[model samples]
Target: MSIITTATALLADIAVETDRTDAVQAFVKQETILVQITTADGLQGTGYAYTIGTGGTSVLSLLQEHLLPLLVGEDARNVEALWQRLFATTRATTTGAITSLALAAVDTAVWDLRCKRAGEPLWRLAGGHRREVPVYDTEGGWLHLGTDDLVKSALAAQQAGWAGVKIKVGKPHVFEDAERLRAVREAVGPSLHIMTDANQSQTISSALQLAAALEPYDPYWLEEPMPADDLSGHARLARSTRIPVAVGESMYSIMQFRNYLEAGAASIVQVDAARIGGITPWLKVAHMAESHNVMVCPHFLMELHVSLVAAVPNGKFVEYIPQLRAVTRSEMTVRDGVALAPDEPGIGIDWDMDAIDNRRVS
Candidate 1:
């Protein structure tokens, strides 16, 4: 058995491909925090996590100064045990953003190492339920886009054979959101699934009003209609609406998800690998969702989530939002409507070291 010999992390700032406006805010730079770990025997693994706009440095510092140090003499093969160790050590920051983000980096690194050692792809190693998964486009739907443009983008996605398109809601007036969705629904027709997101910008009254307005259009799910802390609100909203309440990207821990499931709040679980403390907890969340009879449709980082989604029985649609092109050498392989998991070893992303260096800011 080889012991871990080294650990390092990099901070890269990658810009959004487009404006990326939602109800809450526009995406700034992705503060990419990359983690690399190598064993005494020369086996290496790469893992990464990112902040949508800020805190990359804190996450990086946490990795370099705290988490990765713990990994220096640890067993590289004991992925779950390592995760528990990291989780237990970070009790002060439990259920917060920075600690989990740092934990995700190390947890993913070990999982990548384990997969590489086993000579198997992560999807198979994780669960291996399927090889390909369906995708939906979030790139085409932004809060800034107008009704005409929204309809055009939705139709384009439909023509391209994608399963669905997510449209941002949460306008000052619920009618405005309804109008855009109505126009898109009318143009793309009822065949294509239309997912709606409020980005946690709505209140109970407003969300219910918007839900009433959106009901006729048949949205795939209504995402983040309120604050993540409002578990009771989410439950009320879920019970009130015909649409499923999709959540978890805004959530960071498994216990939060457990509470949501126990309360019968979430209909679809968007268990982000980065936000959920990497593939280890991400899988736990997915299987947990399966037990609750809810489907998992993870948020962004489509490249990583594609394989994870394919790995589980309850996994559903993978959101297609390509933000890693500037840092990675390869794009996700999509054929017609489906995205395929990488058959290669490791975490499956081909990092362009030179590009990463070029994008490095700290």
Candidate 2:
């Protein structure tokens, strides 16, 4: 067994392309916690997780001071056992963000190590259900964009062969949000899929109203209409709206997803691998969604999510929002609205060490 000889964690602050504002907060930068693990056999693996704007240092400290040391001298190949040990030892923070993020960093590194050792791409190693999954563009529809700009961007995405466009909701009034969706729908016509994300900004009543108002536009789904914790509210909205309910990005554990899925609160699962404590639990959620006859359309980290999505039979769409252009050498390939999973060994992210070193915060 190859023992974990060295483990390190660092924080890297990657800037967003523009000021991305939603109903809740403006995404200023991605505070990423990057982890590196080296085994006694000279094999190395890297993994990462992120915070939207703050607390990256806390995640890094959690890994360095509490989590990383646990892996030392442990069998690197025992990914599940190590993850369970970490999860149990960090039980104090079991249901929160910091612990999940820390676990993601370590768990993903272990997965990468396992895949590399087996000499298979992560998609194939995980479960090679398909090589290419459909893609949708979310960057073109930020809540701050003007109606004309939003229309133009949606049209451009459609012309570029994207599977669909996601528009941010939560304007000052329900009419304003409806008007924007109507305008985009009229421009893109009836065939193209249009998804709307409210970023967890509305009350249950407001979400019901907005969903009714936007129903005529034929949106594919209404995502995160209210705060993620409101399971009963989501169930009510899901029942009230004709549009499918999409959620799970804010959720941190398998049980959270189970609650949403079992309750029939969400039709589409937007499971973010990092936020759910890495690919280990990510696959668990995906399989669970599959068992429930639901679809998995993961949120963010498109570069990493593409492979995870393609690996599963129930994987539906990969959200297109590129973030690692500067820090990673590899980019996800999209052709005719479908994203091709990377065939390289391990997790498929080719990190630029110099860029990572330059941006390292801790």
Candidate 3:
């Protein structure tokens, strides 16, 4: 009765703030790929994946032309099996961003179906680990934000009871990034954790210098200090830094995490569920990270990640970046520096279908 009777895909082109810059690039638009599935028993579910700005149409094509077609007549409950099937079908596209993003859209829809059948929230059903994960503000920490503005943002986050505020590093000089971290630390007075994201924009040499300069300020973590592909370089940088190195937002697979963990290269694993396919593998990565004694503080899409983080014991901080307010019925609940995982049964998002239609691009 759980056989998937219908599967469909659509595109939502959402505009983001023009000034949201990281060390890598300024984000302009978000291409939200939404997938919906219906079971033979008449239960329905929706799931989605997102891209920064480009290649979203490619993801949509993969879904409509190839991936979504495979879901028909398949039991929606077979998460792992279906995921493997999709992976095998798209074997040529493995390690590619567009392919994984496409798979994630459908996989999350299937998860939404499973959760609905269980009558349990994803956080509890997935692991029942905990509800309230500590929250950190990344909206205030973009690299383009001025030092004075950085202080103001950090203080605002502190005043709002957030546990941490991330600062985007990678200025022209190591000292400039240090000065920004110093200002944020001074403004928050050291209790609130101050993390830094280099956005995988630095070279090994620059990362080493920046890490050394920021050590005095006691950053909670230094994230993506170099490119995600450079495993050996990351290992070397991790050895050199007293600060824990965090990575994996840009990574597209579980094997990449296996390599990082095996090498002791990254202390915090920022596995983005969308980029790594979906909730099925997301849990696998979380448990893998836990086994390695590494923390899991995922990158973005806080709407979905709040539940995922709450589902795992190794889950660390939920980065506060609200991206779905325009298309969702309500915002996620956060109070006193903690995010509460949704208690809803299906996928945890109350998507506004009309709004999604209005925003739909394809």
Tell me each candidate's RMSD, in Å, in order: 0.8, 0.8, 0.9
Residue pairs with colliding backbones in model 1 are none
lDDT of 1 at 41: 89
The lDDT values for all models are 0.91, 0.93, 0.91
TM-score, structure 3 vs. true: 0.98
Residues 1-362 of candidate 1: C-alpha lDDT, one tens digit per residue: 56999999999999889889999998997988889999998998999898999898889888888788888899999988899998888899888899889998888888889989999988899989998999999998999998888888888899999999999998888999999999999898889999999999988998889999999999999999999999999999999999999999989999999999999999999988999899999999999999999999999989899889999999999999999998788989999999999999877888898999999975
Tens-digit lDDT string for candidate 2 (1-362): 48999999999899897778888889989998999999999999999999989999999988988989889999999988999999998898889889999999998899999999999999999999999989999998999999999999899989988889999999989999999999999999998899999999999989999999999999999999999999999999999988999999999999999999999998999999889999999999999999999999999999889999989999999999999998998799999889999999999999998998898885
Model 3 lDDT, residue 161, Cα = 93
Q: Which ten-residue region of model 1 has the weakest summed lDDT?
A: 61-70
Task: List candidate 1 segments past 4 Å from native.
Answer: none
Best by lDDT: 2
